[model samples]
Target: MEHSGFLRRWGTLSSFFLVLLLAWGRLYAQTPSTHWSDEDRISSQVIKLRNGITLNYAVQGDPNGPVIVMLHGAGDSWHSFARVLPLLPANYCVYAITLRGHGLSDHPARGYSRADFAGDILEFLDQLHIQHATLVGHSLGSFVAQKVAEQDTGHLDRLVLVGSGPGTHKAGSSEDEVTSPFAKLTDPIPYTFARDFQASTIYHPVPAWFFEMMVGEAQRVPAATWHGLGASISAGDPLEDLKKIKVPTLLLWGEKDSIFHREDQEVLLKNISHASLKAYPETGHALHWERPERFTSDLLAFIHSNGPNP
Candidate 1:
């Protein structure tokens, strides 16, 4: 009887542990990996431009290394590059900026135009004494970078435009009837709208943590800024300005990009003197989010390559 009781006790203990182990395994599977949550690798800072607008930015890599300034898309902050920042080499100093009226940047009553945005960037470079640096911009930021390059190419080493088009709206679109969904947005933008908007940008899967972070970033912008930016984007085309960008330029696009089409890339190439395009297969508008490793590799190759520009 004693031996039988001991056997029963042992079986009960083993069963309890098995249940516990399975529960622990389920918990671990549900939790996001720490690899994607490594925000400690980068440092955040805020700068007040001479125009009195304060902009927030994230910095990473060597301070004394080659300079590279990144501009995020509409309604996004420097955290948009969270995945890409950690992957960059230590030899390059990167400044990923959150544009005015977005992220933690000061949102004034006006000044949402591309020209206004470009002006702030120029002043930012001057304040930091960045005489020459490569500029990387995505979507709305790409247009702003074009303006910056147009206004002054002497301060720039190279230009990279990701998910950009010749213009935000089709030619001849009136400002009042702009084709942007942001124009109709009201204060306290719906969470569903923000989530769906972000979801539409990526064809590939991203970490749940990162996707939620992006949606949160988009929700931070106010309605007035959205209306102002939407109107500004619809009011102008930067094709003429592209002719003025004399620096080596790289246009990064995704094959399945719903925003900018192949024709837009052709127009960009035709205008810029030294420009090349690299299209990612099965990627979408947010190529960086979809394939950050490939994006970083292509960016680094373009920066270091001595190959002739097409």
Candidate 2:
């Protein structure tokens, strides 16, 4: 009787969730995030790189304050940063870059290394003639942020690595993903790029439409880009370079992150000098998206309290 009752309850809940997903697909149907936005009310720049790669970036808030350069992770465009932009305190200029092949940016044949992305950022800053900026990176973006700091850019203020490590961490490839429906219990993929960041969390009063938007985003990227980039970021260990980074660094992790586990966090903390560590409970890799208010509050407090930008 107990087993039977449990099965019945599980079935009922599953059915309910299915309906929610379908409703989101129909009711909140949104076009591909890649759709261009004109009149965004934000300063926009199109940078053509030295290697024939073109990237798109958007700036918001006070243009005069210390600059903040944000980098998104794999399979995500600048839209991933869309949530935190408006929440930023006024007078802080924030620039979000859409990586090649992700959003409006052109997909180049190669040159997807961390250095490649950092080079683009360096060029972008030089073009604008900005001297210094705070670097905020999420996931793969975190890795890029470290590189920028290492370059001795003379303008790098500090580094905030969200849901990422100071160096290479244990993540897997698409082939390593366990896709069985029951396998949902074991998340082999980082929630950020999967577009399932919402479902991977234990967010209370979970907004019904957030996960649905992720599904829409996954559909926008071709299967090749999805699998290729995931493989790329997970392919090697990049943490040995962490010691080279001299800027003040903040390392954040999701409590429930399956990809970059606590072990990964500790290892990163050990390598990077006195890197401050913070973890969100019951949250997966995309805590920022899953819990925006709490995430921003914690982020801003840390930023303001840190001794005058390193």
Candidate 3:
């Protein structure tokens, strides 16, 4: 293909969105991630940050066991990992985090970038007195987790990234949409052109109930907050920072992920040494939610094989 033809071919509107999502961290992806409930066999609490921010959190399994922090995607609460919680061994303790502005966490007026989110996680860990643990992040959470690891490499033992976006400096908009509250945020919450672009995402049989639940949850977010938070998620580049990570890592992407294309995964594997990649066939953006059994089982097997991070 000629240069212009190739550019046009690769320059689909959705393709640029794929780049934005890979770069910006937050995109409310909460499906089952409503507020923590008692019937779910989970315990909930609030982690208070020194800055007067209170982040809502939940825990499942033995509290005294080795720590495993769970981070949700953008627009989602910690409960997004609800199904995966039961699959863990009793010896492992898990804490699910709600991003500052989403879920029940306190949303400040400013400080909405991935770096801010990473700092929030650090504060959460500090409050819990959790000295060390492995970190697992999904989508937007993956961005924050990646950023968090950069802040304190010593704090993360093993890192697991699920359906993580790539590192792009651009936010992928043809015109300046940040003119207003609604314009600043990504439409599908993940991509600016998600309604049309999501076809390129993951490939699971999207159930009606899940879609409805996600849609409803997202609709509740105030337009201004959502857009402002969305703007914050896409403000910077984390690709250069990715090279700073030396910890053992596992990178997983749904084979059908339209949000993060194959090229994005290739970039990750190429850049991160000691990183392994797995593509879940028939799965889309929400790999864990779409195939809980397979995702959790694969996660368990990988962690067991690697043993605890030293």
Encode model 2's per-residue lDDT on 182-252: one tens digit a residue: 12322233444455533543343345454555555444554444544554564554667788777777877
**Candidate 2 C-alpha error for residue 18, in Å:** 37
Off by over 4 Å in 2: 1-45, 169-210, 307-310
Candidate models: Cα lDDT each: 0.85, 0.67, 0.70
By TM-score rank, best first, the candidates go 1, 3, 2
Winner by lDDT: 1
Separate clash counts for every candidate: 0, 2, 14
Write down the TM-score of every candidate: 0.86, 0.73, 0.76
lDDT (tens digit, per residue) of candidate 1 on 6-89: 999999999999999999988877664334344566788999998999999988777888888999988789988888887887
| lDDT score of residue 235 within candidate 1 | 79
Worst 10 residues of 3 by lDDT: 173-182
Model 3 agreement with the true structure over 52-150: per-residue lDDT tens digits: 889988887777887889898755687677667876766778888888877788866667778878898988887777855778999778988888877
Candidate 3: where are CA atoms >4 Å away? 1-40, 170-202, 206-210
| Model 2 lDDT-worst window of ten | 178-187
Scored against the true structure, residue 4 in model 3 reaches a CA lDDT of 83
C-alpha RMSD by candidate, in order: 4.1, 12.5, 17.9
